[model samples]
Target: MCNALAFVEEPTDKHAKSDGYCGRILRAQTQGTRRDGYNEFRLRVEGDPENYQPASIYRVTLYASSPSYFRGFTLIALKEGTEGTRDDHYAGKFQIIDEEDTQFMTNCPPAVTESTPRRRTRIQVFWTAPPSGSGCVILKSVPFKKILILLQQLLHYYHYH
Candidate 1:
């Protein structure tokens, strides 16, 4: 389920270099003012193949498993319809596991208005660079397609418990 993944270096913000698309590893070493290799990536759900749009939702999780200093990370889900767009939709934040690592789980970061003629869907995860210049960032893979399934399971578990 962790196949569909895209690694981008600060696509939205101007702090880091913009590494358009380069699979998992955006850069092997940091450089210039971009001393931080931090970045944000989107897990999109364009909908079914046959039908143009199908009812859908997303579940996003951010996990940091590194041995260095990390400021924090934010996850946001934005939606754009035939009419216009949305704002800084804060999904959730990663928990500071220690002085250097953290993890986060969004029960169901706001849903996209499927009936609002929404053409595409995306889960954006943003990360900050480690202060120690350790050049170490570890993140678990998030499957783009199974977002609905994972969200359902999370919701059901939350309600059931």
Candidate 2:
């Protein structure tokens, strides 16, 4: 097991979002905590306006909690400029815990990986383009615990019925 310490950080850079058909940029953010337990946080991303060519970028962050401290990390995602091909990047990048300037933990579960580069965790940003949409960012924290919760919910629903 690793020594638990928490801290706060932001994504590598900011991003702009165009029509989802075109691609949206991805960003990362990090924050820290003292207690090691199940937690949930939110990330906000905005799209460009209808008159501005439908393009904008936003940042995303990640956080970790320990018995005594908190840690964080971040990254950037760029829109590829295609129609209906903009994919999520955070859902693949690994969570970085930089202590002594070295990334600590590696890949883990509950986080989805795609045919793209393999990553530890992905900042799941749920949003829709302009003209008609409300954005929602699902920042998945504890993968294992989340999976358990999902399973439990499913089981509860399955047996309770």
Candidate 3:
């Protein structure tokens, strides 16, 4: 019963071909050392040019079979090619829901912000795996609108192992 989080990223382009969306699972790997009835894990996700667009915010949600085995989650955005600089361009937050799910919201900095938009190839999330052994975790992502748009148009299905 390894703990995990799955997620999906919708295509940035509304007119994208195919089903008009893309999804994937967040890969979980052992991180550091486990101690005090808690285990550390890192969830890594890659961004695809075909699915990701500049200046778009993606809402990622993590679902667990049971909340008792879940602990807490954190996201740390780091600057590219820098050792100690914190990147503020991207913003993210996590929320626990009904003891069964966790929602993560991430905002990508606007492409036009600094004359040159930074493209992120990867995102890293840190979480504490429950010692009680949670079954599995699922992560999903969808587009977040800053302007008026149909709520139905924003819905899509994506599943990852």
Tens digits of lDDT, candidate 1, 50-158: 2111122323333222222122222322111110122232211222323222224332322211111112223232332222222212332322222344335435644
- Top-lDDT structure, candidate number: 2
- Candidate ranking (lDDT, best to worst): 2, 3, 1
Model 1 residue runs over 4 Å out of place are: 1-126, 133-135
- Clash pairs detected, candidate 1: none
Q: lDDT of all predictions, in order shown? A: 0.26, 0.27, 0.26
Among all windows of ten consecutive residues in candidate 2, which has the lowest summed lDDT?
A: 21-30
Model 3 alpha-carbon miss at residue 82, Å: 4.2
lDDT per residue for candidate 3 within 1-161, as digits (tens), equals: 33333433331212222232221111111112234644222233434222322233443322222211222332322222221112332223222322232234232221101111222222233223223333333332222122122223334322321
Measured by TM-score, how close is model 1 to the native structure? 0.24
Q: Rate residue 144 of model 3 by lDDT.
A: 18
